[model samples]
Target: MTSLQHVSTISAPLPAPSRQPFALALSILLTAGLTGYLFNAQDSHASLVLLLGAALGITLYHASFGFTTAWRTFITTGRGKAIRAQMLMLAVAVCLFFPALSAGELFGQPVNGFVRPLSVSVLFGAFIFGIGMQIGNGCASGNLYHAGGGQLRAIPSMIGFAAGALWATRDYEWWTTQPSLAPVGLIDMMGVVPAIILNLLVFAAIAGLTRHLEKRRHGELERDDNGSDQPWSRRLLSGPWPFIWGAVALAVLNFATLALIGRPWAVALGYPLWGAKAAEAMNLGLDVDFWGYWLMPGRDTALMGGILEDSASLMNIGVILGALMAATLAGRFSLSWKMPVLQWLAAIIGGLMLGYGATIAFGCNIGAYFGGIASGSLHGWLWLVAAFAGSFVGTWLRPLFGFSRT
Candidate 1:
């Protein structure tokens, strides 16, 4: 997500430009190579998931879809265009997810929602994650797409995310013991139709509130209606797509993920595993031997397996490659390695918070908030409130790290 200082206001459309042929070629090669490797080594499903991830990356990049930026802009500027877009995305997702989830299967494959317990762990973790994302300048999904889009700054943030996730593993069991309510799904409490209706009402209320605030503060709503003047074919391939398009694409892609993987799309779950893999390669301590998370049956196998074998990891790679391809196609794949000391420090600290918070909270914005709410999990609502509060504080703290509030 672009920082407040970097936020684009309404402007005349730019002409379409040529693609970065070398970068585009490289991205395509990497994506195709990984897809083929996953297909041959794992199965057709793995390859499909990877492609889905790439598509998500492309959508996110083209649309500039972002959580951190959306929240920050709302807090600092009262512009809720992106926030409204998020509400739209979630609304669409629930409309698609609720019925399929209630049925217990899709196309003969068992499927489940991301319903998780509501707990103090979630409150604290999500709160810190909010702060971290503000300083780190990217949420989990933001980190992947930004890194893939050739933002070199995200590299340190991602590195810190991995380390923080690994560090959280040392105390995962204790956090789980924090006071909590059992997992509660709105669909379980009410029927699917009722749950959907209730969720839609809440989404409408939020969107309406944003509009009211923007009207009061700015005297007019900021429109997300800007894009290139190119033909449809060119715009589809190289884009600054309208916000609604991004929202719909994300919602549909998430639905596709559920049908393929039996679970909603997620990103943070793969970070610790990646960290552990690096640690193992460097002769660091084996987390599987000590960390309770890695000791679990499913996680243990994932830890022991090939890097590309894990769906989450593979999907993460796809997101990066996809973003690369998107940026290259749009002729905007520049990478810069310049940064001040304090900003760099902020990135590291923020990333640590993002990883640690997501680990304890049971998910980042994508998994816990987006997936959870769409699945009718009460925890998602809790995550949204807590993370938003944390983001408020984070927005204020940005100035300390050389970031402007507005």
Candidate 2:
């Protein structure tokens, strides 16, 4: 890639507004009611965590912290700042998670990390998910926030994602049948302190490497980001937030989720559960409980509950609504009826593939990559490598679908 191609770009900036009072009022009132109801109906703990998820959505939108765009920029532009920021976030998360996980308990509750075996399913699933991210124009979390923010096309992508995830459930038995290596937890093997040290070392090395590559290619580290001279409060409410700030906040939020939920955060697990509920509602009579994939106690129970009762579902809703609120505040929340035929096609296909891939892989970016890595799973490292490779292929296919590359 040339120096010209390495520069970052935002094709469409969010529209400006002095205020979106209606959205501001609506967003707060609706969520407050839901949170109050959930506190009475469910646990106060889960309700609070759901609100945190909304905060995450707001942070994500304001910052425009995107894995898809970041990866695409790196692939096409040789920019490594985003990747470095990811490393920093991961490093902080590692510090926070290790001591908690290594103790094998938090707040008097026993907890464990996701440490799944290395399998063919993970490799292929993450790879396909990578392609889906490019085509769908977002990852699991990305799709949620963008959809909430009234990106009309995100709805189709989300539908496709759920469809694809359910479709992959049919092959759950077959996918796992591929010979696999046993799961390994770095903490379990090397102890908490060693795991933290090793992870930090790896993160530092990667950060250093990206810095070298980017500087060698582009002759500088920081990208041009001229900001508006708006008041602090106004700018805070309406934003194109700093990428590093978003990254740090996400790491902290994920840590909080772990503390509250007793496990690492997961974004895509609810997709299939939502599908099963929909199928049941439609009188399709899907025997999800009998399905071998959800034979476990946790999976089985999540299936039995209504969507609103599920914690992950609540969090997901919060994220979408939060993004909606943020976009509204930014005056960027508007529907678009017109989309290119190929773009629509890409969205559907990409979403479906993402859903399918995430199912097989054990999680999406949040579940497998972020939480998995923070929890010291070997599968997380492999997911990163495989998904990046898939992104390379997906980037090549983008122009064929009429997405312009910078």
Candidate 3:
């Protein structure tokens, strides 16, 4: 193809010049601010570790998705380098959380207050979440990242997501009031260490099996014109390690947030809040009732409830800033909007599902799946299974609706 043709075909939307710089600076400022906030607010060292793990997870996620070269290489070669990074993240989380179980503390604080959901509830929520993410074309975190990257489709998806979350929040009281719903915790398990070991074993077995299958099928395929032969080491270092480090840093920040804030980190609550606010503005009068009764609880309301109920919103904003900063610095900001109509609809539906499911599950991919698994909660694993099953079903059905796999 000619140079002009190539450029035209690959062109994506670019963030405004002023917004680009603002996004970068804002990201840095938020990281610093949140970190300081967490340190001052939390008391647990384990919570600090969790915050660090979360940061690492976000960084790796960005590196895996935002970097076109790395992503392309992985796609061409079918390598697990990115997946390995995720696995390592889970490993670190498992290691850190298991010990906290035995000690009955997270970062040296009591863990009794953190609530867990029943397996059945988690599974049901996961199924809904899976379908939502499939339709939405991204999960909670995924939406923020894509939006920051200038995907216009994400805008509508997020709107739908907020609407769904608002609906769920309005109905949260009735849902939690159900007899089948009860707060659960991992302390009732055989302690954290055993749980960690078991999880590690399972992860190892799965990794080994996956590796074996890839080797058998591809026979160490070399990089071809299809861009498959990139060295693993090169791929690992191609993107900014600082970005990855930033994600790890976010994890540490989250731990501090939990200790200080008395709740795990999250990023979906904001959607619901926005939904509620919008409804209120429209004279629906949903905000006062929803915020007063279901969202806020206890006499120390301002100090405690605000932090837990609003953590997801804060995190969601941070994610957008973070991704924007990463993209701008790398000169990768694009405003491209070329998705088909079907994909757009899918994204909207997915966002709605994610909002509703996350509220019911009491978390999203980050809170329920990642945090739950890290805490050695069985519910986290169950969510993963259900979500994955849903993802597979979504993938299979996508062709029927003209959504192609990336």
Q: Which of the numbered candidates is closest to the native, going by highest lDDT? A: 1
Model 2 C-alpha lDDT per residue in residues 239-289, reported as the tens digit of each score? 765567777988999888887778887889878877777777888866767
lDDT of 3 by residue, 1-406 (tens): 0001112112233223355676557655766666566656764342344344334334533353322222222333555443334455566666655565456566556642234766454666677777666656667766676566555567777888888877776566666666464544554565666666777787777656556655766886322121124343432322234223433444455454455545555666567666765676689764445343244654224223443234455456556655555555434456767777787777677778878877777677777766776666666767777876666566555565465533
Which candidate comes out best when scored by TM-score?
1
CA shift at 216, candidate 2, in angstroms? 2.1
At residue 163, what lDDT does model 3 achieve? 85
Estimate the TM-score for candidate 2: 0.93
lDDT on C-alpha atoms for all candidate structures: 0.87, 0.80, 0.55
Query: Please, what are the lDDT tens digits per residue for candidate 1 over residues 182-300?
Result: 99999989999999999999999999999999999999998776464556676678877888988999999999989999999989989989888889889976544577888887788
- Give the lDDT ranking, best first: 1, 2, 3
Ten residues in sequence with the least summed lDDT for candidate 1: 4-13
The C-alpha RMSD in Å for every predicted model, in order, reads 1.7, 3.4, 7.2
lDDT of 3 at 234: 31
lDDT at 311, model 3: 48
> Which clashing pairs does model 1 show?
none
- Candidate 1: list runs displaced more than 4 Å: 2-19
**Candidate 3: Cα lDDT at 301:** 41
User: Per-candidate TM vs. native?
Assistant: 0.96, 0.93, 0.72
Clashes of each: 0, 2, 31
TM-score between candidate 1 and the true structure:
0.96
